[model samples]
Target chain A: MKIILDAMGGDNAPDAVVRGALEAAKEFGVQIVLVGRGADILASMKAQGWDTLPDGVELANAEDVVDMHCDPAAVVKQHPNSSLVLGARMLAQGGGDAFISAGNTGALLTAATLLVKRIRGIRRAAFSPVLPTKDGHAILIDAGANAECTPEFLLQFGCMGSFYAQKALGIESPRVGLLNNGAEDTKGDPLHREAHQLLKRAAEQGTIHFVGNVEARDVPFGAADVIVADGFSGNVLLKTMEGTAMFMSDMMKQMFYRNPLTMLGALLCKKGINGIRKTMDYRETGGSIVIGISRPVIKAHGSSDDAAIRGAIRQAIRAVESGFCEEIRANIGQMILPREEEHAE
Target chain B: MKIILDAMGGDNAPDAVVRGALEAAKEFGVQIVLVGRGADILASMKAQGWDTLPDGVELANAEDVVDMHCDPAAVVKQHPNSSLVLGARMLAQGGGDAFISAGNTGALLTAATLLVKRIRGIRRAAFSPVLPTKDGHAILIDAGANAECTPEFLLQFGCMGSFYAQKALGIESPRVGLLNNGAEDTKGDPLHREAHQLLKRAAEQGTIHFVGNVEARDVPFGAADVIVADGFSGNVLLKTMEGTAMFMSDMMKQMFYRNPLTMLGALLCKKGINGIRKTMDYRETGGSIVIGISRPVIKAHGSSDDAAIRGAIRQAIRAVESGFCEEIRANIGQMILPREEEHAE
Candidate 1:
């Protein structure tokens, strides 16, 4: 299987992306097509003491670069040869089985949606990010794709998210939970209340495994395999968790370095601290997968390092192999109830 | 000067409530009125070996208790003499300057809104929780009060939140931020976008010190004095932070207790750890204050210990002394643009 990487993306792009591609090629035995400026890619490879391109690796030259601040809608028209757009084009044309980028999230999502297109029956593509939990990891869908979602959008998110969890993470009949303020069915705003009923119906019909409402506090405790929410609330929850984790880690570090005795304690506890940090690290999960699209498109973090890039590659390979999109296309009908019938209720 | 307490509320019940009220009276030198079953209050006081009630302290009899599971809307009619309802009635009748409860949040909100009433022109009461930040604290308004909000409601939340921060927290000009997914004005759903425009106009009019949009990640870093969001997102952000904090603390504890070496490290770093813990403690901030009401009404945490209850009392006293509600009433006109003009815009 061939995977396409956006070489001129992310904060540590070109160098880190090239190196990670090489590592993934060598370790995973997958062919990697790096799309970026030809000279820059070669220079980055040479910087790492590579005399020539290795086997199972190739390059697709693209002259332009898409900055983080670029408009998502304007990227396709303006930066036609940008690495992000080129990579998406390559995947769309069947040149690569999957595509990955660590560039502008909006631009990437736009490119994937416009280029590869959404699945025939899918209403909108959802961004599903895997977050680490106590015992396992849970997938938070619609993390930031559609900020304003209807009940129908959320129902599709549940279906798509459950499919990804089962195919990618290998969670059979993944438990799908609606993210809400409280665990009661009566909780949440109008959208959630409506979505809850729709999801409950879908679950009863065996479209997905529907757990009851899961509160934010219970999210980190492995409450469900797939936690579904509108992009607005899901984005807030995801970012808040990230911020709190960073704050606590920084506080712990400051505490440990306050005095000589504490510094000594820090030294003694280094192993355990590292373990916890590793558990919380995003590099392990690679990035968020854009679900409901025609093809697999993984979005690595913009600040992704070599390990994160490699993780993204692994995720892309698994997505391609699992035929996750096929699963969604086959089962999404059962998840989405007809609008007329929905309104009739 | 008088503060009413629902002694029959919270997980700790009459014991912790009585002790906290007694401590608040002694520490703040303020009058206290404990409302609960008369016999239970006396027994709890006796259990604490306080043969006589302290000066500036009194009790009001309440026949029923509002349990956590009770419906908020039903509490007023079903349990009219419940501690929560009776306490609100006391504040409404001018028997106390402020009311504090650690009972059912929904019930407390309902009782306070129905009995104490909303400030003139305020459409709805909002739950504003003071969250501890690295430097100081920030108030998250509409934390869990109104799940579905109009642009008008959010504008009021901003107005009320700004005033509360200025009067209660002593910020001369509190910076009110609209909680959103992105900092850009163009970002977020329709509601946020409309609310953003309204808040911006309010800020331009010098009604609030509006600091554009604030993402959830920036909330913990004290990006704004008042972070205003619809209750759904606000509740999610609040709970996600709590969950993340708990997860980190638990992980740290597990790491420290992994072996003797780490345990020794933990002992040596106890002071520093305690300092960080204290900084992150919710007890220091008391609890969420129900803003937009006629008088000060503070909702303490259900599982609050003595310290949390004491903190809540201090907050209530501060709110009452600062004339927080009066401050909102006096300046709310400027904060809320005329509805006709709002529609015109």
Candidate 2:
């Protein structure tokens, strides 16, 4: 299997990406194609004591890095040889089985849909990631992929989320829940009410285990393995959790370091505290799989380190090994009958 | 000032309530009316010794306790002598300066709205609570009262929130922000877009200290002193924060109990840890204030103890002393002049 890495993507990009890919190549024995400006990638590689490319690693030269401020569509259209663009193209052309980037999320999603394309029956792609919880983890889909979505789109999210959790997270018959204002069908807006009906129908037919509406409070408790919402709410929910974790970490530090005595206590329990921090760290989770794509495409964090890069590469190899893309294609093809009425909209 | 305490409310109820109220009465020199079944209240009071209802404390005649499962509106209407209803009535009739209860939230909100009534200029009432954060705390209004709200409602929430912060939290010209998908007014749904415009107008005219849109990620950073959102989103946001906190607390506990060495370290810093826990404890923050009411009405936690009840009474006294209700009325009254003409359907 071959994986293409956008070495210019995150905050700690070239160094982290190079190191991660090298680690992944050694462990997984899979070819890694690092696509970026040749000189920078090579310098990063040489700095790490590599006289030449490893047997499993190769370079696909691209000239530019997309600035955070640049218009995503125009940049992708114009900068054909940009690292992100070239890396995406490699996956589309069968040069690599999977693609990974931590660059502009909007651009990554857009490129995946437009270039890497979607499974035949998919209406929209979702950026679902598993949220950590006491019971375990729950899948939150459409974490800012499509701002607006239909009931049909939500029903599909349930199907896709359940498939991913079942394959990757080792959950069987994962219960899917619609993220809503209330647990009752009569409690939400017209859109949620309609989606609730569709999900109920899907559950009846056994496509996915629909557990009805789940309030935000229930999401972090792992009340349901899969929770589906529109991109706007999902994105806000995901970020809120992340920001809150960061906030608590800061507060815990202040609480410990308030005085010399507690500061000593902090030192004594640093190992235990570090364990909690590691569990909360998103970088260890690999990249969010751009589900509904024809091939595996993972979007790592921009600040990803060497460990994160390797995680992403391993994620790609696992997806291929587990036949994730094939499972998605089969599920959508079998369950979703293209409705002419939807197309008319 | 006299405060009504629903002795039957909360998890630890009578014992915690009895001890907490006794401590507060002795410390704060405030009159306490322990309103519940006479026998239970008297028994608990006697347990703490120095009988005869004290000089400042008295018992109001209230019979049955409002259970959590009871229908809020039905119970409030049918059982006029229920602990919560009587407490609200006492506050409304000036029999007591404030009302505090740890009974059913729905029942409290219902009875308070029906019996106590809202401030003259306020259309909707909001539940504003000070949520714990890394940077001390931040106030979130309209946590979960009215699910569907207009832009006008959101603007009023800002006014009420700002007043509470300035007077109660002791912040000058408290920064007010509308919770949204992004900072831009053009972002988010039509409701959020309209709210952004209204908040901008309020800021321009000096009605509020509108600092524009603040995302969920910024909530923990002290980005704004008050976060204004419709009840649905606000409730979700509030619960999400709570769930995260609880989840973290549970994880920390597990880590502390992992080994004998860690357990020993936990014991050494037990006092400091207790202080940290107290700081993070939402119970210490008292009850959610039902803002926009004619008088100070506090809805204590359903599982509140006597300490929480005492804290709620103190919070109510502070609310009254801070002139929060009056300020909300004044601010909202000014906005009504032009709004009456341009009511959005």
Candidate 3:
């Protein structure tokens, strides 16, 4: 298997990206095509004490970088040769099995959607991130690919996310839930009400395991394996979790550093505390996947280091091997509304 | 000031409610009218070792209780004699300075909106909860009052929330921010985009401290004093915070209890750990106030104990004395869209 890695993306690039790609190529036994300025990639390798490239690793030269300050819509047009745009183009042409980027999220997503393209019947591509839950983890779709969405779009997300969870996360018949203000079927705005009915219908047809509406408060408690929402609400949910996790960690640090006794206590409970940290760590879950695209396009965190990039690459390999996208493509018929009257709106 | 409390509401009901009312009357030097079944109130008081009704304490017989399982829209009509309904009516008729309920949130909101009514010109009442932050706290408006909202409703929420934070929270010229997916003027769906402009206009007109858009991630950092959101997003933010905090606290407890060494560390740093708990404590913040109503109507946590009820009563006293509602009433003309074309939506 081969993966296209955006060598110039993310904060630590091209150093972390280069090293991560090399490590992934050797460890995962996959061929990696590193796309970026060849000079910088080589320089980063030298900085990390790597004198030569591995046998399975190759470099594809792309000089420019996508500027985050530019408009997301105009990124691909403005920086045609940027690593993000080029990597996406390569993936589109079947130059590689999957693509990975940790640079600009909006730019990467924009490039991927416009270049790699979504599935034939998918309404919109989505950014799906696996969130750490009390029991294990749950997939949150549309973390911010489409700010506004229709009921049909939500129905598609439920189906697509369930497929991703079942294949990539190794779950069987994943339960899908609509993220809403309340769990009641009758609760939420008109859009949610309609979406709930559609999801319920799909569940009745046995297309997916629709678990009804789920409140955001119950999300962390592992209420469902797949949580579907519009980009706005999903983004809000994802960011709130990030902020709260950081805040809690900060508070815990303060608690542990209060005095000598607390310091000793922290040392004694170091193992347990480390376990909590590992569980909440974003990098532990690897990169977020931009689901519904024609090929696997993973978005690593902007500040990702070599370890996170390596993890993202590993995820890319799994995504490519899972055939989740093919499943979604084949089951597209079940993701849409059958009512003609609904389409008129 | 006299505070009317729904004694037959919340998980603890009469036991916690009556004990809390008696405590508030003694400690805060305020009169409290406990609304519930007279016999149950007396029984609770006696159970708590209170031989008689204390000075400045009174009871109004309310034979019925609002059931949360019933339809929220039909609550007042179904439970006209309920503590929540009677308390609201009493507040509307100037029978008490303020009213508070730890009962069904929907029923309390419905009763307050229908009986007390919103200040004239107010679009919709909002549930404004004061959320704890790293620095201090921020007020999140329209937590779940209206699942669906217009730009105008959001605009009103901004003005109302600003006034609320300034008066009740004792913040001078409190900064108001529209909750959004991104921290940009052009972020979010159409509702947020238009609301952002409206809030900017309000700020330019010197009506409020509009601080542009605030993402959910920035909320816990005390980014703004008043975070305005449509009810759906606000509820999501509020509940997400609650869930994350609980999840973190639970993890910490597990960590401390993991082994003898960890237990010793926990004991050593008890003060700091307690401090973190106090900061994140729902009881410390008291109850959430439904803003824009003609009279102050507070919604305490349904699971509140005697301490929490006492805290809610103290908050009610502050809300009644602050004249925040009057501020909103006076500035109603400013919290609207100026363009006619936008109103047509």
Candidate 4:
């Protein structure tokens, strides 16, 4: 399988991305296609004592770079030759099995959907990010990808999220949960209530394992394998978790450096603390996967380092290996679109 | 100001409630009326080495106790003499200037609204809680109080939340931000979009200081003094913050006690860490003051201990002394009611 990497996507681009790609290629033995400005990629390669591209590794040239502030749809349309857009185009045309970018999320998402297109039966594409928790990890879908959604769209998100969890996370029967105001079926607004009923019916038919509504507080504790929420709430939850993790980590550092004795204690437990930090790091899990598209496209964090870029490439590989797109297409195609049409009316 | 306390509420019950009330009464020089089984209050009183009931401290007999499982509205009607209901009633009827309860939140909110009633022009009441953040604190308004709301109702939340911050937290021209998926005016669903427009209008009129939309990640860093969101989203944010705080606190404790050296280090910084813990403790800040009510009524945490219950009582006194209810009535009354009516049509 071939994976295209945006070498200029993240903060520590080229070096970090190239190094990470080399590591992934060495370990996974998958073809690594670095897509970026030609000279920059080659210079970085030469700096690492590589005169030429190694076996199982190739370079794809793209002249221009898409900055983080670029308009997603406009950039993809105007600069089809840009690395970010071309990466997605390559995947669509089967030049590579998957594409990864740690550039502008908006551009990445737009390129994936507009270029690669959504799978048949998929109402909308959802982004699922694996959140690390005490009990392990849980997937939160539509994490701010599409802000507004109908009940049918949310149902589709659940199906897509569940399949991703089953195929990628290796969960036998992923417990799917609807993120709602309360656990009761009658808890949320009309959209949530309708989705609850649909999910209940689906669960009864064994289409997906529904665990009912899980509140935001339970998200960090790994309440379910696939936690589906509208983008508005899911975005808030995701950012809140990220912000809290950073805040707590900062506070811990302060506590450790307050005095000599505490600093000593910090040093002693460095390994354990590092373990916890690693668990919370986004790079370790790769970036969020833009699910429901016809091809695998992963979004790396804009500020991601080479490590994160490489992680995103690895995730792309995993997505391809797991047949994520195919699974989503299969599961989502079963939904009745007639009700959705009526609801729109 | 005379404050009524529900001694029968919370995990610690009469013991913590009685002790906290006595302490608050003595410290603040405000009358505290403990409402519960007289025997339990008196028994705990003697154990605390009190020779006589302090000045401005008294008790009101209420035989019934509202359990966490009881239906909120039903309980208020069924148990008119229940501690929680009677306590709020005292504040409503001018028997007490304010009321405090660390009981069932649903019960507290129901009784407060039904008995105390909204101020003449106040449409819906709001529950505001101070969330701890790295940048200090941010007020999350309508935190699960009014789930479904019009944009105008949310505008009132911003105003009321701003009032609370200016009076309580002492921020001048406090920044009010609408919590949404993204920071753009066009970022969120219809509710958020309309709310953003209303906030812009309010800012233009110089009625309330309005900041642009803020994301959840910025919430922990005190992005704005008053963070306005619909109750559903607000509640989720509140609980997420609470859960994250608890999780971090627990993890810190576990880290400290993991080894003998770390345990010794914990001992050395015991005073400093305790100080931090005390500040982070929601008990110290008391509870949400059901804003827009005719009188001051604080909804203490359901699991509050003696210290927390007393803190709630004191918060009631502060709310009354600061004329928080009157301020909200005067500042937010006109806008809030008319907005609700307009949205109803």
TM-scores of all candidate predictions against the true structure: 0.98, 0.91, 0.98, 0.94
**Models sorted by lDDT, best on top:** 1, 3, 4, 2
Q: Could you give candidate 4's per-residue lDDT for residues B1-345 as a string of tens digits?
A: 788889998888878888888888888888888999887778888988886788888889998899887888697778898899988888788898888888888888899889989887666889988777776778888888877888878888888778778876778889999999887677788889988888888889887889889998898887888899988888778877776666666667776778887677677666657766865789877798888788877888877877787678767767777876678767754465454557563
- Determine the iRMS, in angstroms, of model 3: 0.9
Compose the digit string of candidate 1's lDDT tens values, residues B229-338: 99999999999998888888888999899899999999999998898789789898899999999999999998888889999999998898888899899987775667
How do the candidates score on chain B by TM-score? 0.97, 0.94, 0.98, 0.94
For candidate 4, write residues A198-217 as lDDT tens digits. Answer: 78888897889999999887
Candidate 3, B1-345: lDDT as tens digits: 899999999999989999888888999999999999999999989988998998999999999888678677898788899888999999999999899999999988889999999899887999988898999899999899998899888889999988888888899999999999888688889889988987898899999989899999989998899999989888989999999889888888998888777788788879988999999988889999999899899999989999999999989989989998888888888875556745576
Winning model by DockQ = 3
The lDDT per prediction is 0.91, 0.81, 0.90, 0.82
- Candidate 1 stretches with Cα past 4 Å from truth are A342-345, B341-345
User: For every candidate, what share of the true interface contacts is present?
Assistant: 0.79, 0.47, 0.88, 0.43
Q: Which stretches of candidate 4 lie over 4 Å from their true place?
A: A47-49, A337-345, B43-53, B268-272, B333-345
Top of the candidates by lDDT:
1
Q: What ordering of candidates by DockQ runs from best to worst?
A: 3, 1, 4, 2
Pull out the clashing pairs in model 2.
Answer: A10-A302, A11-A302, B11-B303, B16-B306, B17-B306
lDDT of 3 by residue, A122-238 (tens): 989999988989999999998998989999899899999999999988999999999999888888988898889888998999999999999999999998999999899899899
For every model in order, what is the iRMS? 0.7, 2.2, 0.9, 1.9
Docking class of 2: acceptable
Give candidate 3 regions above 4 Å deviation: B338-342
